[model samples]
Target chain A: MSDSPSARASRTTGTVRIVGAGLLGASIGHALRRQDVDVVLADVSPSQLRLAIDYGAGRDARDDDRPGLVVVAVPPDVTADVVQAELEAHPEAVVTDVASVKLEPFTELRRRGVDLTRYIGSHPLAGRERGGAISARADLFIGRPWVVCRDEETRAADLAVVEALALDLGAMPLEMTPQEHDRSVALTSHVPQVVASLLAARLASAEPGSLSLAGQGVRDTTRIAASAPELWVQILSANAGPVVEVLDALASDLREVSDALREPDAPGARRTIADAIRQGNEGVSLLPGKHGQNRRFEQLIVMVDDTPGQLGRLFGELGELGVNVEDLRLEHSPGAQFGLADISVAPDALRGAVEGLEARGWRIAGNTND
Target chain B: MSDSPSARASRTTGTVRIVGAGLLGASIGHALRRQDVDVVLADVSPSQLRLAIDYGAGRDARDDDRPGLVVVAVPPDVTADVVQAELEAHPEAVVTDVASVKLEPFTELRRRGVDLTRYIGSHPLAGRERGGAISARADLFIGRPWVVCRDEETRAADLAVVEALALDLGAMPLEMTPQEHDRSVALTSHVPQVVASLLAARLASAEPGSLSLAGQGVRDTTRIAASAPELWVQILSANAGPVVEVLDALASDLREVSDALREPDAPGARRTIADAIRQGNEGVSLLPGKHGQNRRFEQLIVMVDDTPGQLGRLFGELGELGVNVEDLRLEHSPGAQFGLADISVAPDALRGAVEGLEARGWRIAGNTND
Candidate 1:
């Protein structure tokens, strides 16, 4: 959907072979085919390979086909074996594996005594809750980070080929070592998954009445807990070292807070609890906003009736006022006749947007700008 | 805006006095005043009281005024003292305090050996990130759970008055004991706040590059960590017993997962991690949906260009097709020029909505109905 002419022109040259026709593999094939590059699809599961091809991702591999580049997209558990097999089969081509954990596969390949010069480990930060070719989209990787784990021993030409693949798929290529890449994801992705799951697990024995009182807080914190356990088990095991580090730190912090709550009047108990939250405030502020900067957008909550076209009318009026909503969340409790459409706009645009909406008979429930 | 004649007729009769003209207090006053009930506002801060009155929340308290109900909405630390004072000052009035923690104030008043027949502890599960009379809204409690703690010694008439107050504000009144209410909120609210804050505090020392790779998971998990530490410390401490119970349980799960990750190849390690996530799945499923039922809605992610009117056009088309969106979330990456408006509708409406949008020249990126 985001294909650009400049991006299409710089697409990887020559025929490309993809092993493991899953979501990532098929998505790559689709994006590459849009650029008019030749693609060959292969997978251990004949049904999966056939489905990917039927979906127009690519064509089946032929005996005479000589690929210039091979991409491996498979689960982390079998990623190294697939990458090694592809490398041995295509000595003339650069090989890249898009496994979530870069270090494990790279280390496994090196331990197997495979030559690493032609291999580049990569991971694209894009996915859906569901998996397989059915969930594949040509623009899945667009504007997302595609980390390339490169070493000094790698040839520039080989590195360029993998980077070109990322670019052709509309992903921004970022260079990092295998260790750095694993550690980065450990903090940003893996640990959050574990924490969310652990928090949600506590609710298994909770009373339904307790859960009936659940608000946006617990909902936000546990939304990702609905992820498939089979997939996460592999991910957590593959990146165990880094994930363990972050989990241990979180456990220690949790212990201190729990102990303080157990004896709130004890010396420094309140300070300990307060400091944990204060540090949290500092940590969350470090995350980049929509424009990839440390800018804080002003927010307005406009009440909308829970009827068809009410949101359409509100947003339509917002458009007429020339206000661009940077972020939006629609919140409505059960049994309520109206919903609150919380929207964020640039700080400079907050006053005018609020004034225009109020003038247009919209009820401003709340605003951060006030 | 939802001031139905039926709701207005059932409003608490005579004058209603509100102590501590903060967010909750002023919001209660606004909603009650909308029902044509007289409200008198009082606060320690003269400016706050003046501002709340000027905002049409209520009028200045007079010596000649005799209130039939008094609502005490003060900070948790001073809630007990203020409630005791208000009860002593208004012997004939049925007094209710809208403090977050019910057990503390009720216990303190009982410790003072004061008559508890007129006092009913209540909490409306409504708040904004910002506070004060300036943030007050008449419909703040609409369709929200309003927990009222009543004992056997309470008279039916007094309880009826409190229930009427809840109904007049458009809240669903729920009856619970002081202990039960505290425990329920601890499981649903207090512990989640601490867990979120502790998880977010880990990001304070993370590399900026690592933060750049942040995605929807981490963003949702830590969103509530931005809450004010001063307020959270009081909440955590006031309900420390129940909060500690939950936190300890969470810590045990975290330790088990951490240890398993530390030795992923050990026997039963994978099963341990998988079990935690599976239990999370079961736990999150217990929460109700937007329809006040356990119904699962189908989701559709429609891509919208990041322009002023793109969202309006999309929703307008959806309205024309007669689709009622149950919930919506807008997602966009930093450098992406487009955003994805993920909307959930009734499962029965999914096919028609998707087909209608596709026919209208809209790009339907993904849908759960597939």
Candidate 2:
């Protein structure tokens, strides 16, 4: 989980004026500061602004310099106006806004006759459900993906500056068109949050005392529901249309599943259930792989008893084997036997992990290739 | 995480017949075997039958001894047929099941005119996604929930016996009607799996290059998608209507969110998105506080830098505080500064945990009681 600091600083051709002293703003400032680049941090709330300053994200605006770059990190609704205002105050600063959805802000800026040659859009894929400058950290962007979007009019130099900033913050630059970014996130991120919340919402209406028995599956699936409301609104509103498309497809699948269950004994009923499962299977396969597919991990399924010390011993064995576990997932179906732990190890090391477990007389299911 | 075992052996009224020597069957046999109670294990697969014996879930069929209890732990599609056979073969034995969905098996047995006095629909809220006797665990149900549905024909003594069995297995007994159990699980369990898989399937089609940047959120959200397909089909089919209903509602919310994003400035769009987040917040509240609503400890949300060694120090301070953590959930969100950690402690020890963090100048959020 540790990412080394960026040893070589890319000399910035422009200074980025980061307005908004919240998590994103502070992080941007922190990243720039670490690279020893000049940055001016501004915020409406004096307390928040002071916090950013105290945290060393940036110094005061009167730092004897005009910013060549401006990154606006604020709420979704206020983002565009902030960008234009920053642009109006400094006509030369190549400006970009860090917001979840791009199309709306891009249109708003274009409508106001902003300098398209200097402007671009970006959103760094690094955050917690928690918010505020209080939650800001310097390495927030380390090894994270920061998405950058540019249209035809944008200057190549401006794009490079943004890319440099992303790299300076320890984030990998991901290039995509505005529409592509919005749609992909709609399927990948936005829709999933809504689904998680809706699913968790049902627990409130569950018959009395039913939830007390809830296990890890419900806990994991509903984890995102605890996310802050204002933040989600910013995300859901920005990518609403694309998200709706995915939901509509899911609705169609659900309807068919419903009809199929009503008459399970009817002709083709078995196929109906099977089809729903297959559709779900197909749908889940579209997600990005681990570290955006840079790491290929094999799923090692080990059947573990419900006894104490079993998991510890199994993990100890793996540790002894020196199997570098990339990830671990536990499945607790509703009333079966031992839990199956699907561990992700380096693709090449999986055979060893499995062989080690097998030699220790552990019953393994499925090959690592699975 | 440890619970004391039952100090005294449970006095069994008679032998228990467990049909289907797969994971669940073998588990129940192991649990009861530890209690020194008689159990008979049966299954369609001779290999599975042998594994159950090898695992010591039960003795051979000749030891059936006219069981006083019969448990069905097979496929959902065949539950009713097998339960009917068990009922016909041993009319004196009380019947129960450890299947995912209850209504189907209950109705199936009733439709076949099986005796109701000895029949009580029960579902143990413990499991692994894996199947087969090789995966069986004796204490699978320990400290979990065991839901039992009782009818007028269900003998009070038999219900008590089942409850006693649940307690002996270290599970808390919960009461539910057949319909409620089916509907609740359909929403909370089966639908989430489908939804998670549906989400994961989308990742499979992701540009291999783009997929590399995938992070923990995507991985956690899509975790359940890796579950076995056939088992889920049986579960979804058995509780189709309610599962479909939940999915339908989710789809509606998804459509609304999507439409809002397409034209975010449109009337009522922002409120719609906000409502979805608020609904999710409320849903999160309904989940059992730490430890299935039995908060054995207090919760402390610590705000830490995104830098390395920060978290290790935070945990080290907790260890120095002389308080052990029960569980932890970490996230790397998209577009945020710092990660907020919610750590739980006993109610009385809450202040100490807070003091320990604050003494070290860690900004902590949220109170256990509040």
Candidate 3:
């Protein structure tokens, strides 16, 4: 439960007060309570405050001892306002935020001349389709990555405390600049949602019969389209520059492919198609590979049954054979005999996993190694 | 078990004899058997045949009357030879091949002057990650769609038989010209796969530590990357023209996006970014909407608890309110007070679902019809 690098080496009696009592704040409180850490949840919205308390986010806020830390969980637009308020109330407490974008808040904090030593910026890459305090869960951060953005001016003690917070919440702590974090998220999350939403909106106007022919492929591409426009509008506007930049790059690649298709008979079509595919391959590497770590990876294929027990049996076998199951994908092929299971593992495990499956009475065919 | 539109109309028992006891063939057998229709499963590989039989795909080849429908479900390259073999042995049978792509076989069958009245082209929109008879299930085709393609010269009875076959399997039957079917699929499924694969392949080579920050968005985009390249190569090569066209269009869009990003402050940058998102929306609409139907939707926010019976309670409220939920998204904000639930229902039912929740001691917020 403690992957965060900043967690204290020794146990102690101290409170980590989470200000805002929203999604991130409440979820952190929930996770902390599970760890037996003293926590207090504060929110200006009386309704929101009551919800947090009733939902067991934390006990009511108290003004006694200076807190070990104060985590500001709020929207990017109002984050600095809440953070400044928290600082005024608890100056000795270290602070951090779990906002989607960070650059603006950092600047706003600096302008206020608040001691910057005790605060860091954290964005845990764990969330669902919903938002707000009611959506908070103690286990939401488990086994997920948490990025900590630190500047040269960030105090080491505060940074360590923030890392400890992430660890206590059961998230892996990662270090990056605010810019890098924003750009990566734009490429991976924000942009995709925008794309999905736009697509979904279009379908709402499409002819019913035409869309009736839709299958799983379309479903996959549009899964995130159901996101809230209000939330996305805030997110996109906050990270507009980087997010727009990534989309521009993607658009250019799309244009080149379009041109290549226009001249199908030209000898260049193959190269263009090949290049497009290759480009996608390259871009995808920036994502966390199958290990849920952002490692660059080649794909490996394994066939698995669609039945409930089959997945369990397959996972159990891979474990027994010492074949690291880095990541697995199940294609939603409609009415075929068996579901094609593609597993992405280290290059080293490819051969063994394939051979192991074959020996275990599984039909292992095609190139098992990428 | 009683969905055959033509079963009572025609007393003929044997139809669609599937050759090759593999995944595709087994699924075909399963779908056909559900209609109380007998499908003979055959394979040159005796062991494979036994496996298919074990999975209840068919009876021993020694049994039954001459089949009216003959299907070749072997690997793509062998599809032609097997189709020709079945046609030769069962001259009275209407024949088809369930290959991923059909241009080659369609031409081959034409050259052979096989009974035009007894042959057509069909592809079912379904399959799993795994393969072979052991993984077969009777309900594989339920509610999925099957595409049956025909040309001007196609026999009337052949089209009817295949359409009936689809109905018998409880699948929606869609009619298309062979060329149209190929191009549509190229846009919807094949190209998407190549793109996903390309991206996933790229992720394979990314920096190890950075990949840890990869999240669900990347996973969703690259899910199809784990496909078997050999199988994919065959599919792409067969539909190169249409696939190249779509990929090129995508590439064109990508190019525009990249060019805009190069000059971030340019007016063109904003326009390009918006266009890319808009196009994505347009493309997404080409997909089926929620619940396998296209319906205009708005979301209703509900505060749901994380307790054991809480989800049930929320669902029960929705059910009691008589709201047919169109879609639902769940999120757990880390530090927030409560989990957020976004339920998509028809515009008319937004008030009802919300009212139902509120009446059950649940709190509702945000925009709802009520």
Candidate 4:
């Protein structure tokens, strides 16, 4: 949640031009327009431009209009070309691109001997399963990381303008070099997607009965594997170097695990298996907890009947007791008539929340603190 | 959510003797005792047996007691030995072990020339992160799959006894041969665990800034990597053959993807990458939905404020509207005060639920059906 539009004066000025009226472009248009900033939409496809305009994203760009900012939000394959074109077309304006991968296009432009002073490469780590102008939302970037890749050649004013754009869209602006941005996302996003996809691919040929015994582990691990291949191919190809590095390391680790399992009783084999899993424990612990804290939330699993209002009653009761649910997950089995609602709360609030719910006649199936 | 204790007459008859007194053993004891069945508990550790008894899991084993059914619930490493000992100690009793792997122990027994006519191997696909009697719950097996490995040599009466145990403890019993059980779990459970761990292990050396950019994708893929190494080493080693098979295939797939990314412009490189991801899409679709259906429930994303009562009010309103939420996932950002609650419901209920929530002043951020 953020403040209403125009809660503060806009740091961005003048008419903003957005090329490629797809999800990112249309979303930026919508957010900027919500703040009553002038936005001009442009797309190679007339129908896409019309659709984005009809969605109230922005007005059509006019030939004579002089814009102060240009945003290239096209596919990764065409991002560098469009960014270069936009920079040439609006030489006086600050230009930026919101592609998923930052370094590829940045390097491409540098290789082309293009002027880099007016252009900044950035990526907002925000998206939905579906894409297009039709799926655009004004708040898509709220509270999400928007990485800004800047270099010594980038002017302070141009950098400020890009950061201001991120802030205007409710995104947290994080500065990272092009190399750093590429490496960070390779570890965090790109490799995870590849691993998830490969793992899920294994399941396509799995027997149905074997799949019937699927629990939360397989479901969570492979959920992202359902992403669009067309979109991922472009993104993966763009960040190939870093992505391959991680994938290669992962494959090596997997082989070690396989080898260790194959001869678990052999000297040092069990130790290899144990170390891999133990390393995972240490690695997962490094992740920041929800709410940007290092501590993990205490989880309470409460049983809820499948009937319509059971969860409502439980949450309603929790509300009455002044207990905030920081996060919630509903676990349901294939044949179960009831589900388990795993409610997470701050550590200090766990006891009170559990006691309150229990007193309200809710069964506290289990809790982490217990 | 199952029938209250003794709502129906249990098919399981006679006293049940449970060995090991760990999570599974203690949990079985608790469930049987709740059904008014006499239970005798044993463990190699006296403190563990005392703890289970003090927790009301069961009574201590007596010298003269005769058990009609004996459940060996020790660690996977000693499962065969314990099952063999239980069968020898209770010659008249139907014996079963709850080790994760089936074929290894069964083969071990067969190699020892032990009679297994009274022995059944079953594994309940249920567990918590923490183990031991302190983490045990009577309803651990409710609605979960309990795989029973049976052979032609096993008597029908003995097979029925094991199935009855599963049913009485609120599990669905699925019969399979030891080989089938091993292969099934190797694909579904064991392989996922190894993959998750190996992937998460890559994060150990990653920079904290990179980790700070982590999203739901990484979190879900690596969630199970936190499981105990001591337990997993035994399970993976016992199911090594099948586990290694899947791991080997997965590693091969990863190498192909890496090679493709290394030369994405080479003929068929892009195709290979696309095909891997496309296969993943197909594979993920094979998984059953939460309600045991092939159909996916439509999802609606609603923005909920950080306040204590916002989610409670939202669920309460949905309850009043008679729209049952099939599954719920909360998406929160590190810096955001509010989170997005993605609620899944029946496809037909989408329109009405959206209209109702909109009229109730709830902002529906997005929906899948759109």
Fnat, model by model in order, equals 0.75, 0.35, 0.23, 0.79
- Give lDDT for model 2: 0.72
lDDT of 2 at A302: 73
Q: CA lDDT of A11 in candidate 2?
A: 57
Candidate 4 lDDT over B233-277, as tens digits, reads 889999999999999999999999999999999999999999999
Weakest 10 consecutive residues, lDDT, candidate 2 chain A? A330-339
Which candidate's lDDT is highest? 4
lDDT of 2 by residue, A271-357 (tens): 877755665566455544434333455777776654434554676677668775455555442333345566667778888888888
Q: Give the least accurate 10-residue stretch of model 1 chain B, judged by summed lDDT.
A: B1-10
TM-score of chain B of each: 0.97, 0.85, 0.85, 0.98
| Ranking according to lDDT, highest score first | 4, 1, 2, 3
TM-score of each: 0.98, 0.84, 0.66, 0.99
Give one digit per residue, the lDDT tens place, for model 1 in B1-370. Answer: 5644235575589999999999999999998887789999999999999999999999999988889999999999998888888888888999998889999989888999988899999999999999999899888898899999999999999999999999888889999988888988898889888888888899888975888888888989999999999999998899998898888888889999999998999999999999999998988888777747788989998888888978888888889999988889988766778777889999988998999999998878788855
How many clashing residue pairs, candidate 3?
A: 103
Q: After superposition, how far is residue B330 of candidate 3 from its true place, in Å?
A: 8.4
Every model's DockQ = 0.77, 0.30, 0.15, 0.80
Winner on DockQ between 1 and 2 is 1
Give per-residue CA lDDT, model 3, range A148-202, as digits (tens): 9998988887788888877776666889888878876776677666545443444
User: Number of the top candidate by DockQ?
Assistant: 4
TM-score, ranked from best to worst: 4, 1, 2, 3
Better of 2 and 4 by TM-score: 4
